[model samples]
Target: MASVLGPLQPIVDMVTSPLFLQIVLFPGLTSIAIIGALLGWLERKLTARVQLRVGPLYASPAGGILQMFADLIKLAFKELFVPENSDAFFFIMAPTTGLVLGAALVGLIPFAPGLQIANIEVGLPAFLAIITLSPTLILLAGWSANSKFPFIGGLRALFQQTAYEIPLWLSALGVIMMAGTLNLAQIVAAQSTGWFIIPQALGAFIFLVTSVAEMERLPFDLPEAESEIMMGWQAEYTGVLFLAAQGPGFVKLYAFSALFSVMYLGGFLGPGFLPPLFWMLLKTLIIIVLIMLLRSTFPRVRLDQLLRAGWTTLLTLAILNIGITYLLVVGLPTL
Candidate 1:
């Protein structure tokens, strides 16, 4: 038995290495994808209940929890169709780019105490930069289609993300100011005294709204408005191509929810009864539910209204929050 197992031991050791486990298992790509799928079902179930309909129930006999996995399999087997006029290379490359960048953002987030992939000093900025990658991919996805509606939707994506990103970065600056560090794990530790939400409520609100726009979620989902633009930027995608384009959006939703929990909700810091990961996940789930509720609750905003809110309302509030946070950080020490 020892001789038989000897040859495979190195492979097993490599698979069980700390770096490999952190990158592939807990708080990694697989975990994020699984959680994203589960959240998708939860979103559907919640929206259905709101609309007085019963959501997925037959596929697995357990309220159709397996629906997402089944759908992924179906999409994987279906033919990928690229439009005759489309730029085949970029049309294929765009979604792959988005998925990779979105997953990269997960690597920056700390799941629990001593459970982060990398502990860079500039973790927050690294995260923000990785998030900004999506809009460029969105533009590519739309442009590669070589169609009018997709072109327009891609422009809208650029405009919307640009408008919101400033507020998102500035709002995060408020937390950074309070915490006095750009390291995410350190920021969570700072919150051992108190969560940033209490002092930076306005900034937190701005971050939440802008993140919705960044993710192109409901009420701010102008880039993919099905009724207005016929699936918009994703119109030319089919099968696994469609999945590649759409999967990142849900992953970003989960990523941003976790970001919010870590930044403003004290992250993994919580009561002793549960593991830190559990507390972190609970906070993130609450944010996810709140985000999903907006899907069925509100009508999509007009482009002008959406842009105006981002430029005028959110930006102004974010700036004010920064000033206020600066003052509290500077003044509170004297008392």
Candidate 2:
């Protein structure tokens, strides 16, 4: 068979490899696209129900489950044109790269035993570092439009990310201190006695807040405020470019929610009767719902107010949480 197959054998072997499946199928491009689409429908359905209305219908016969797919198709089909004198190369590439980075964040997350796409030792920090690049890309996308509104939006993106990013890192700092490991899988292992949420409740709150801000959910959605900035950084984007601009948020939502589950809720740990994957997924879904609910209820905040909260209030809380963590580690070394 080897003699007959020759060069084709290695291609088959590569296709069959678990690494390929992990990257191209489960936790990579295909899964990210599907999950991001489904999550869009979920968010709409959840918000609609909360506000007492039928959300998406007619896209799919069953509960409009295919609405997002329909929307994606529509977006792809729409005609679009680039602004004159704009840096068209970056105007198109930035959002596409942001979507890829969003999927890459999921690559580091452990969904179940033996299910991680890349179980790097510094998975936690690497995830943060990769995601931080997203806003920079957004800034690039906005600036590349070569228009007044987008330039302002681009500046806002830079400022907003700069404000919340530190608190985000500090919030996770307590997790690192408690778990005493940078590897996400090992962090889950450290929660064998109890979840980090109990001791690091304050940090978890800061994380939840910062995560919502980082994802630019309402109240934190100043950069692209539809009512104010006419969609802000994405004003000039249309058709597939528009799709690229919008898609990353949902992907990031899934990745960030999964990361929260891993860091606080214990990645895939659960009762013997329930599969590890089930628990991980259920937790991730719950966090996703909570984020959607927040979107529906939280008032849009001013950029200055949001920045102040991030730098002063959230920063102080994050620092205080770290101090508490130090005391706990000193008093209860076994924990």
The lDDT per prediction is: 0.89, 0.92
lDDT of 2: 0.92
- Model 2 regions more than 4 Å off: 1-4, 332-335
lDDT by residue (tens digit), candidate 2, 13-69: 899899998899987779899999999999999999989999998888899999999
- Report how far residue 100 has shifted in candidate 1, in Å: 0.8
Query: What is candidate 2's CA lDDT for residue 150?
Result: 83
Relative to the unseen true structure, what is the C-alpha lDDT of residue 55 in candidate 1, on a scale of 0 to 100? 94
Error of 2 at 255 (Å): 0.3
Global fold similarity of model 2 (TM-score): 0.97
Worst 10 residues of 2 by lDDT: 1-10
